[model samples]
Target: NKVSGSNAYVKSCRRDGVTRWSDGNTVSGCDGGEAFVCNSQMPWAINDQLAYGFAAASIPGLTEQQRCCACYKLDFTSGPVVGKSIIVQVVNSGPDVNPNQFDLQIPGGGVGIRNACSSQWNAPSDGWGQRYGGVSSRQDCYSLPAAIRDGCLFRFDWFKGADNPTMVYSKVTCPAELVARTECSRSD
Candidate 1:
């Protein structure tokens, strides 16, 4: 019971229907099962800060019991974002795995500001790759700022807390520096 899900209420974000896109957008409780895809720009760009987006519908069973979700760490496991880290939040709990849309919290820092575009598209093939190529009904991710282009693709780990410090999520990677990085409210 004490996974430490956020006390903040979980509410459904506006249903853009693959129309959700933008930076600093606040989304929650979206049943829409749109997904986050990998994006990129050439590396070696000095200013790397792309505000990626994502949203998810909670596991219907898990939603009632879970209070909040904390996106503690991010990994550019797939595309240009490999080896990079950024900030994010769980915008929605869904019907399934994919989210509706995400409000990237950071700006001009890691992945800069990704302007409002479209969420509909094929999955990313480069970073983690995907079921489809980079075809989207949305705007071009490359059209975003120079920062996001640098390190584009990433997979985020949303976690609460474990009942035991010794335990961990079955789906999440086992340890730190191996796959995804980690952070806690205590550190904040």
Candidate 2:
């Protein structure tokens, strides 16, 4: 077991008063932005070994500016949305929505309306029912929303049953593969 300060920076990252991610303030960026190494005896610390990644996506028609960065810690798929489908960027407001209800905001100050009727993950009486088994829809929904309104979000491809949209993602990556067919297309 080793102590900290072995090339470690002491810092924290927070959004809307809740910490999202963090590191020491002395640097511009992380050399490997995924997992960090604390002392082996550090309680509740994440493991160090990983294959990290960072990416961003912008929904053009929806006018959202989300500079998303994700780390592929354990062979997790990289996609338009690293954690959820309706990724969007808004001005100022973040993580402090009333009712503690999660909401997605588009660039034009438009609030995303969840198609509760059509949304695959939500049910009025789901003590155990879920598309991907979570308190919310993040664990479900294989499609990433580019445009959302009128009881439906414009997601080009959606997979049924499986948590990951491998087929759809593969199809979407096809064009990009043409740019470098011999290599794996980096998902962003």
- Expressed as tens digits, the lDDT of each residue in 1-188 for candidate 1 is 12244333222212332232342234322213432322321112222442223323233344523413444334434344444443333433432333322223211112212212233222122211212222121234354344443333221212111111121111222222211211211111
Top candidate when judged by lDDT against the true structure: 1
What TM-score, over all chains together, does every model reach?
Answer: 0.30, 0.16
True-vs-predicted CA distance for residue 38, candidate 1, Å: 22
**What lDDT score goes with residue 160 in model 1?**
13
Please provide, for model 2 over 70-180, each residue's C-alpha lDDT reduced to its tens digit, 9 standing for 90 to 100: 111123234542332321111112223332122222111122221221222222332222322322232322222222211111121221112332211111222221222
